[model samples]
Target: MAQQDRAVQTRERIVTGAATAFYRVGYADASIATIAETAGVTKGALYFHFSSKEEIARAVIDEQHRRVFESAAEILQATASPAETMMLMCADLAEWLVSDVVVRAGIRLTTGGAIFDPPTRAPYDDWLATFEDLVGRAVAAGELRQGTDPARLAHFIIPSFTGVQLLSDVLTNMDDLKVRVGELWDVLLAAFAEPTRLDELLALRFRIFGPAS
Candidate 1:
């Protein structure tokens, strides 16, 4: 049991180290030697856990999805209003993008898949489905204006958020990600929110981005 636990810990350490390396240098520049050194494990150990850099990258992406989906599920369970839950989920994602190396690296790799062969689109698809579900719920509750299509909204939102975060990373190293996301919500809410719910939805911007500064 102890040996299995130790092995799991080692694997986790390697994944974390690889994530940090990938976040700092990007997938093309990140090397296995650097990942192994950062992980404080020999190359042999790293190879034992993951056969290749792509494998490690895949693991990091999987971890990122797991963390995000778990958090979203928890928030959905606790929040009755689908709109509020979606807002909170966006805030949480922005926070993670800024603070978590695994998420940052995973996102970078997922979107910038030119470096990987046979790139995976599963992450984007999964997020789109999640967003569609939330928007459908919100529309059903009349939180959004009539004629809002959940699928179309989700398709727009995921790419929009991705662009905002990528630009934030390039321009400010993500220092402005939270504010940008709040701004995104501001525009989106104006377009889709029911007139009666506009004020409350707009106020959610403050909860996410904090006071003007």
Candidate 2:
């Protein structure tokens, strides 16, 4: 049992180290030797856990997706109001992207498709489905304006958020991501939310991002 636990810890260390390297240098520049050195493990140990850099990158992506879904589940359990849930979900992800190395690296790799052979779109598809479900629920609840297309809204929101984060990363190293995302919600809620629910929906922005400076 102890040996298994140690092995798991070693594997986690390697993944974390790889994520940090990838986040700093991107997939094309990150090397296995550097990752192994950062993890404080020999190359042989890294190989024992992960056969290749792509495998490590894939693991990081999978872990990031898992965290996102976990956040979604928590939001769903806490609130039935889809607008509130969506805002909160975005807030949670923005926070993660700023603070979590794995999330930063995974998203960078997912969007930098030239780095990956076969170019997986699973992360985007999963997020799109999640946003679609949330928007559909909002429309059903009359929180969204009439004639709002859930699919269209989902597609827009996902890419917009992605762009916002990418810009934040480049401009401020994500120090301002939470603020940028709040600004995005300000625009989106004003446009899409029902007039009666606009104030309530907009209020969630403050809760997630806190009072703006």
Candidate 2 per-residue lDDT, tens place, 1-213, comes to: 699999999998998899989987778788999899888899999999998899999998888878877987888899458888888889889978978888888888787777788896998998899999889999899999988999999999999999999999889998888888888888888899999988887777787777553
Q: Which regions of candidate 1 are displaced past 4 Å?
A: 211-213
Q: Write the per-residue lDDT of candidate 1 for residues 46-79, one digit (tens) a residue.
A: 9999999999999998998889889888988994
lDDT of 1 at 174: 91
Q: Estimate each model's TM-score.
A: 0.95, 0.94
> Model 1, 116: alpha-carbon shift in Å?
1.7
Clashing pairs in 1: none
Q: Candidate 2 local accuracy as lDDT? A: 0.87
Error of 1 at 111 (Å): 1.4
